[model samples]
Target: MPGPLLRPLPILFLTRPEAASARFAEQCGDSGLRFDTVISPLFRIEATGPLPDASAAGGLIFTSANGVAVWLAQGGRRDLPVYTVGDATARAAEAAGMRAHSAGGAADDLIDWLIAHTPDLPLMHLHGRHTRGDVAERLTKAGLTCGSAVIYDQPAQPLSAEARAALLGTTPVIVPVFSPRTGELLAQERAQAPLLVAAMSEAVVNALGPLHKRDLKVAARPESEAMREVVSDLLKRALAGDY
Candidate 1:
């Protein structure tokens, strides 16, 4: 007596940079959710090297892990006090032997932390090409005497063939978007399958705009672990056909 077979879980589409998306896929594996993953980076992170001399700067700011990696690659000094947007970036900075503090949220949170704690004057924000929030500008307005440097560039990249196929197929697809820029790029594409999205923040969700998503979930926090939890929840919902 042969019984009916169950359908496979939805594809987990990751669209961060190559390394970042791969790391997230690994995290999903570690969390016991082995859904098939497609790593199609929406942005290629290239280091804009020859970092500016920060001999006069007293503090450092990193809004993304990519910035931290580029900084380490460029032999940027780590002696300055470092503030980061999320725990992941702080952890990356710490791994590089820097004294780093996490705002535990987004750029606004980092700015608030700087305003409250008032770190050393003439702070420098090391970031990527496509960035928002104007961290250094806002900080300087708040009387923090902050400056910024473009350390890397995240130019737009086309989704992989596999990603495009998954999006156009009948099988379900689950996408966990980490940044607004990723969301913006994804919004430009069309999906035929049932698409579920797990966004890292309100900004990400907003950037997703008018995508015809079957289900959408926002992480409770801006950290990577929070996004993972949201994805896990979406997986359960997808399996149950709750979307």
Candidate 2:
């Protein structure tokens, strides 16, 4: 007798900004995962205002690549040292010719690192308006002089038609929620399919509240790499009909 046939893997729904989703999809490809992906950004990254003058700051801080892009677009200089919350943001800063340092993790990791290193006084953090961690405040409380500015905004956007269709279909859908805001946005969506979620942190899962899902998994660490691993595990379980 022939062996049982394998079922198709669930579709992966990526709901970050356009550039960010593309980057994650690219990383998934690099990891040799051939699962289908639908990139439907739920937020649009827009510059809030002109970047604050940084001539007097000892160094620059970036918690997201959006901040780096906005700062670069506004003719911001790259001479000052840059400290970032994660490797990806640090890479973005370095690509712009800035001296970049990565805390290799979340905002809390960056704050702790800054508290230990105690870089030049009055570091300037350029970030979006809807950020969670009070990085600048925490650093300052830790005795490191750090100031911050809101340079970008991540306003919500409706899901694309294709995304809606995917969510409405019977096929399984795997969603990797990177931020609590994204999770909240997803909670408002109506999904008929068997939904599996890979949340980046406890906050992301908490944001889902009472949303119905077939399964949920939180990353071991609040980082992109950890999320990727969580996503992979979800995919494997989904294909095996473990959900």
Candidate 3:
């Protein structure tokens, strides 16, 4: 079967590694949306260590694939209730043979869910060094201790020569910016033009800062599905000479 290129405007993704590119291809293909990717990884994932005690907490939480990987590597529990911030993370948890529970699409939403679901239960949140959310604080307020176990750190990398060329030389690509850091890097490179930013939510939009937001087209949902939907919508709008 052929891929999705039904829309006049081709989608582009701004990410450093081939992972983002590959994902854009699959999602677009499934949705009948044509997309090309740019390598601008923005950050690299680095693993450190597991928790000192490593006892099972009241629940488990994941915000990224790296977090899931690290938790699994550390012999983390596979039976605890897993609260994930993104669909990608949820999928990762499931792939690791764990039961996954989604709490909306972002950390804040997950925190809200935790607040409502188990207000008094202790929880351990697995995340990156630079991850967002104040679930711990909120949980503390509710007389619950939320321990954050940082398994890895993310360091922002730069764009490759090919990526720079694609952003400058070609017409434009639909870059899916999932986090504030990725958005920040892109915002630093171009003041305007030659790229489209598909932000996941209002938080992501603001994370990119005002300058980036001025040029970005946002997604309806903060999930992977919503991000794909925005890619299709933006392509249609771009083809129609409206955006």
Residue-level lDDT tens digits of model 2 in 1-243:
999877776788999988788888788667666678899998988898777888889899998888899999999988899999888788888888899999887888888888888875679989888888899898888888888899989899999999999899877888999888898889999888898999988878899887678899998877788989988888777777787
Write down the lDDT that model 2 would get: 0.86
TM-score of each: 0.96, 0.92, 0.84
Candidate-wise lDDT, in order: 0.88, 0.86, 0.69
Clashing pairs in 2: none
Ranking by TM-score: 1, 2, 3
Error of 3 at 133 (Å): 1.3
lDDT of 1 by residue, 1-243 (tens): 888788787789999877788988898888776588899998888888699889999889999998999899889898988989999999999998999999999899999989998875788999988888899999999889888899899889888889999999977788999899899999999888899899988888889998778888899999899988988888877777677
Decide which is better by lDDT, 2 or 3: 2
Runs in model 3 lying further than 4 Å from the true structure: 1-11, 210-215, 239-243
Give the candidate order by descending lDDT.
1, 2, 3
How many times do residue backbones clash in model 3? 7
